[model samples]
Target chain A: MQCFSCGFNAMPGSTSCGRCGANLSLAKAPIPVTPPRAGAVAKRILPGWWALNRRMAPLLLRIGIGEAALPALAVPLEVVVRPLIAMVQRPVSLLPGVPFIVAGHRAPGWLLLAVWIAVMLLALMLHGLPVIFLLLVGGAIALHAASALQATGLAYRSVGARLAGIVTCAVMLLGLFYLPLGWGTMRIVGGGWWVVPVRVPASFPPFAEGDIIWLDRSAKPNLGDVVVTFRPQTLRRVRALAGQEVAMIDGVLLVDDVPSPWQSALRPLAEGVRFTVPDGRCFVLLPESYPPGGTPPAPTPQPTGGWPYNRQPMWTVVVGEREIRDAGGNWLPSLGSIEGRIVGRSYPLSRFGRIE
Target chain B: MPEDEDPQPRRAAAAATAPAEKDAAHWLRLADEQRRAGSHESALRFYSRSLEVDRTAVTGWLGQVQMLVQLGEYPQADVWAKKALEIFPQHAEILSAGGQAKCRMGALPEALVMSDGALARPGESAYRWLVRGEIILAQRERGDDHCFDKALILDRDWLVPLEAATACLFHNAPAKALKRAQEAVERGPTSPRCWFVQGECQQRLGMDSAALKSFSRVLELSPQHLEARGRVTAGGGGGMWRRLGRLFGGR
Candidate 1:
């Protein structure tokens, strides 16, 4: 295709020029699928009452009727509209010394409570009335309004105005009933009136309810520092620090030739494993995967040596030490079995995942 | 005589190889220098050169994206960020930068979704939380307050929350704004912009003394803080002049 803006030759179907990088598509006039009507084309548009009313009709109807029906609608129009209003309102309301706290006036607590009580009482009263009585009352009101409209012909003259008024009243009532509850529920769900910052200590264990963790890393971490580290695959603990010589001798952990205290907990695998922890690396293990103080099944005996090393059960050696237990009462790995130190607990506890 | 012939060939081979190595080192140094000097445009060029020399230079791509963001060219930055992500999708810095660029372009919801993907990965820095807070602030939706609170809870030292708290103040909660600004200042004492936010929060709360102190700190750190200076004047009263003198070292 030829580039419309730069007039440069481009490969067929290209949207932009390869040389000047001009957008060829934008330079071309947009092709209309349907032509304008003769009447629409001939009219001279004026920027006065007619234009204003035409432009505002949709907005007024949307605000009056569409918004009124919004509470009962499937989608949350409030969520979509509120932000747009706020975005427009911000720049216009930019006055110095005017505290931003006045953006939206929250109804007073007592007023809200009173409204709630009134609504509840009204709901109770309505519920107490027989359904047939409510139906009759509703039917009588409708009959009266229809008769009055038909007799006066005023409703016919101002059908749009009457509809607008009815919609406005309905929306106002729905908003009054739903908004307070919605706001209150939102506040409650968004975590109450006060927000306090909690510092998650680096070594804070994986999320358990009521565990306070310091999330800052202002201080330098030291050896044996219990730090919070997030892991994706599994929840585990760091057994060694960076630059420390970490070796697993038959699954017994050794830090710089000194058997770490955690090694005794992993005695089950001590016979056949020995690996050195490389520099800048830390040893990690999972939290005890088995039940605490439970013994593991004995390893099946195998020939001493074979072409491929025979797999042996190491659970028997590490069974009784501090370990997590499965439902079946088996010993599990501890924090030292993991790869990194705890750094920060992911927030909203719901988002918290196992540290792998 | 054979030795002379061998030296000539050896010299010719060395001459051919030296220019390539020199070119590589020259581009590497130029990229680093541009980055340090805050000339992101030049840095991007140098980084692209470095990448041309060695496609495996992951740092070059990362540097290019970082520079693009610093230059405030988000569209180009976004492209580079995507490239980096393609190479190492789980890379924390790439994820954080990409998420931030998306935020600057007013694509907040998309930015937040990207941030969640980053947070899902193992091992992230406070920068990720900072970016998340920015996106949440831009959204200004009802649940955004919770996101800001969560971001602050995740990284107490992050400055992003202070800015977000200022936004919260604009959204109708001065008390919350003050609380958030205080936490941010406490966490990052050296940031003059943080102190300015604190001053704004304090002024909103009607704590004139505290507000003056905050503005004074802002001036101490950033001498040419015109807005802060104007605020001090706007908050005029008897003790204010003395405080300004003390702040400006007149005493």
Candidate 2:
């Protein structure tokens, strides 16, 4: 055995180099190389694809190792990258003593984290080109390893510390590229997709339980858009668009003088509600029975006041299907209350398609 | 002492010292003393004895009703209020007590009627306004705030505001309850109910740290306040106290 520190050889049975007093066992032995079989020399040079596969085989293996190790490496990357996203969202004003930028619309702190995690998962799932990038990354890592081996003459002990700096930089670069590309794709294919596990067979025909839906958050909801709403969050079909006059007379909805087909299906409570869909406000007609999943009725405390005012427990309207007013007697949800429109269903292999 | 030097106060005063004073007023005075001394059970017993001596003793009737409400015996409170109302149909305080009981029992319409009748009567006190607030809250009316405001304005002490704050918290109007709780705390800084109400308001408003502090203050003021103790434990701040208690051989 040879001493890593002094390059002095020790007797075969010895633990340490006697002259240098160094631990000889710590030095790594050179890996043995196997000679090619004699029959292989008789063969002609391989075809292009065969040669290509040969080159790709080792690269693919290294790429697989990198992809497997990525999630572990991305943790430290998150801590460094998050603050940069925050800084971009709120630029530091150069004014004296001002630390953060003032912006009208600030993205939520969790938004970048969620986007990054999703993109990383997407990168892991994607193949072909990312593998090539990983191959280059593997080479870079090997070069670093070789440099460390020449200096220390042993394998690097601090795997995380040694590679994290380089890996994090690579990840940040890839993240910067991936985020915009993902965002553009999201924008084109509607912001995101969702699964509607609740099956409302009676009201939402053709759509059943556990159906996947696509959401285009940026798209303007129309009169017939089956939109997803936030606030008193719900999924409902839009019946009244902005600038349209809406009236709920005895639980019947009249949108711009046309009695909606939903009116006949719904049993609105006895309340005279009339309003013009104000600017940027649209009326979404929800299903009569809530929990859209057709679940059993959840016990809800009755709205105090009188028994007459107590309607069925629901997100908005408690009165009969015709009633457009909420438990507080507030009108139907406004457009500002909506999150996005359900562009289409994207799951359940058999019924996979767009939503009207 | 009674607010006025009227016949009732004179009778009460005479009853306190007179060797032969064996009347409803004497028992009522003893009940008030017990209540002031924090012996609610004995106070209730004295009030019952007073009411038995003289069923028409309006003060004794109101005292029994108030005690029942305080003890969370709403059904008993309702029965007592109804019995008191049969004798004193037009009494403002009795009507207010009835309204409070009815409101707590979920009889909103009847409670509203009683509260309205009480408010319509002249010489309205803070209790009547507080009852009105409870009734309005039960009715889910927007005028509940105005009712609480009136109670606070009429109350010379912090009791009305503290009770109203509790009622507001019960009705899920924590923002409005917070205002009343703050007023109660300002007026009576050491009152456990005020701190409890403040804690409840802060908890509902998502100010968990402030709520934990408020609940801790409540337990500090009244160590036997189980609700405050529950809030403290629920907020995950009671571990230190428990460990200290264990060190001191306390359960």
Candidate 3:
């Protein structure tokens, strides 16, 4: 017969392949030899039981009193138990870049080292001659007691399974006791403490969380502040505060005597438009997009009676009222009628850090 | 062979092997049907069976709690309410229902605490605030005016301040009563009790004319307004007749 697994030649009556240890007899079809008479069948069953005992007696005796089996089980028990104790006593790592010494002695690093040394010493004491010998003897006694108990039908398994179960349980019990403390130490040392209590502002649409802002907190906010306040709504910044009643003649913002230098910057945002910063308000303009290179555009003579500028609808800050409006001239109430003074910001401390 | 075969064995086998996956859905439907039939005891059984199949079914837990409340089994209701809260702490309906259960149990302090948590969530309903006001009134009735004042501060539109202010006219300092009542009226002008309070405060202050006018206005808005009508009649109102005469012809 050819064994399929290792392609080894086997004897015709062989039940297993000797080379690769594969079952070969299972592939053959069952062939009935003859019909059984009642008395013969009953005798066949009793003989079959006797035959099974004859085949199993030597194997059972060899295993039940085996000298090699004890060492084989003990080797595995030592291999599993020692590593588990070592794992519980292992040290935790601290933060990077910040030197360990400068980060202070009270940090998580020192705490883990002390625990690791104490556990290692305890484990070393337990692994010594008398302790190891006692554990081996105790394990064997427990196995024999469990086997005797199973023979009396109190349980199904012998003491070997019970001792393995006990060692596994002890490892788990020790792990449960120490693993959380070790993990907690590792987390503390990793330096994620800054995340505990920083305030994060609610996000409004169109403006993402990363936008840069310049906060102005001087005196009472003039029309410039209202323009800046509206910029969060418009997603743009205001660059110039053209004084009240400043006329924009031919795309230039002029505050009475001077043709404002900021007018050119404001042109890109609102072209060919003029707006009066209402009483108790100042006109705000976007900063110049184009640089001042050559001689500036020649200032044209101002018109006399009729103002040559068209008024564009823009936000106005009513001083006592403290109300802000959108460009469409409707009240936006949820922002609250009060002008919330620019107290502080909700932003990242570093480029890598998130706004909490 | 077919005639002799026993169907009972096949039936037993099928019963033993039926999939448990369908049990939760079946129990939930049965609970709904029982609830509709007004068999709350049976409904509770089915709902509990559904929960046994899936412990975290929030709706089933809430329904069972509400059914227990309807059955007046307050101790059991309290237990389920707590369990529902543990699952979804910020659920508004559960908080409100739990507040109601606590209120009925005369645990007003705990009820107010629960309602306060509910109100702190963004966009909580005004009805929850109203229940909180009731809890405050309960505290005030027990001679704890500080919590009542706090409730008024949390929700100025609460009607309890008017009732508490009227109670104050007899039991408390008149000045505090008048101040609280005036604030209540201003905060909730359309409220008949607010006007009734105004009348009570004015009468306490000996301003009969203003008191009479306030009472009259309360009656105009709510003709069956009991306290204001009682105050008017008790305070003696030939003044009311005189005003009536002026309205007709004989002023």
Scored by TM-score, the top model is 2
Query: If scored against the real structure, what TM-score would every candidate get?
Result: 0.28, 0.34, 0.21
Comparing candidate 1 with candidate 2, which one achieves the higher TM-score?
2
Tens-place lDDT per residue, model 2, A49-152, is 22232233334435565233433333232223322333233332211112211221224323433443454433322222346437544543343333222222
Q: Is the docking of candidate 1 incorrect, acceptable, medium or high quality?
A: incorrect
Tens-digit lDDT track of model 1 for B1-251: 67556687789899998887767467878987665433566877787777666544556666677666656555446656765654444466677778766655544444666788877867655556656665555444345556666667766553556645654554345676777788877887887777887787777666778888888898898788888888776662225564566466332
Local accuracy by lDDT, each model: 0.49, 0.57, 0.46
Q: Which candidate is the best by lDDT?
A: 2
Q: For residues A1-356, what per-residue lDDT tens digits would candidate 3 score against the true structure?
A: 87643467988888777764556653343321111112323223423332332233324434563233433333232333322332233221111111232335345434434444444433333332345536554553343333222212232144654555455434443354335645774575344221121122222211224432223223243322322233233322222333444444554445553555443432232323344444333433321122323354433332222222224312211111122234311222122221222222323323222211
Task: Compute the lDDT of residue A206 as modeled in candidate 2.
Answer: 38
Give me the runs in candidate 2 sitting further than 4 Å from their true place. Answer: A1-356, B1-43, B52-55, B224-227, B233-251
What is candidate 1's TM-score against the reference?
0.28
Q: For model 1, what is the error of residue A240's alpha carbon versus the real structure, in angstroms, after optimal superposition?
A: 99
Tell me the spans in candidate 3 whose CA falls farther than 4 Å from its real position. Answer: A1-356, B1-105, B116-178, B188-191, B200-213, B220-227, B236-251
TM-score of chain A of 1: 0.28
lDDT of 1: 0.49
Chain A of model 3, TM-score against the native?
A: 0.24
Give the alpha carbon lDDT tens digit for every residue of A1-356 in model 1.
Answer: 76533356998777666864645454333322111111211122211222232233334434565233322221111122222222234422211111122322234323433443454433322332346336544443343333222212232234543454344333432353245555775675444232212333222123433333322233233344343333333333445555566554654556676766543343333343444434444444433322223443333342233323235334233322232222101212223332233344334345443232
Instruction: Give the fraction of true interface contacts kept by model 2.
Output: 0.00
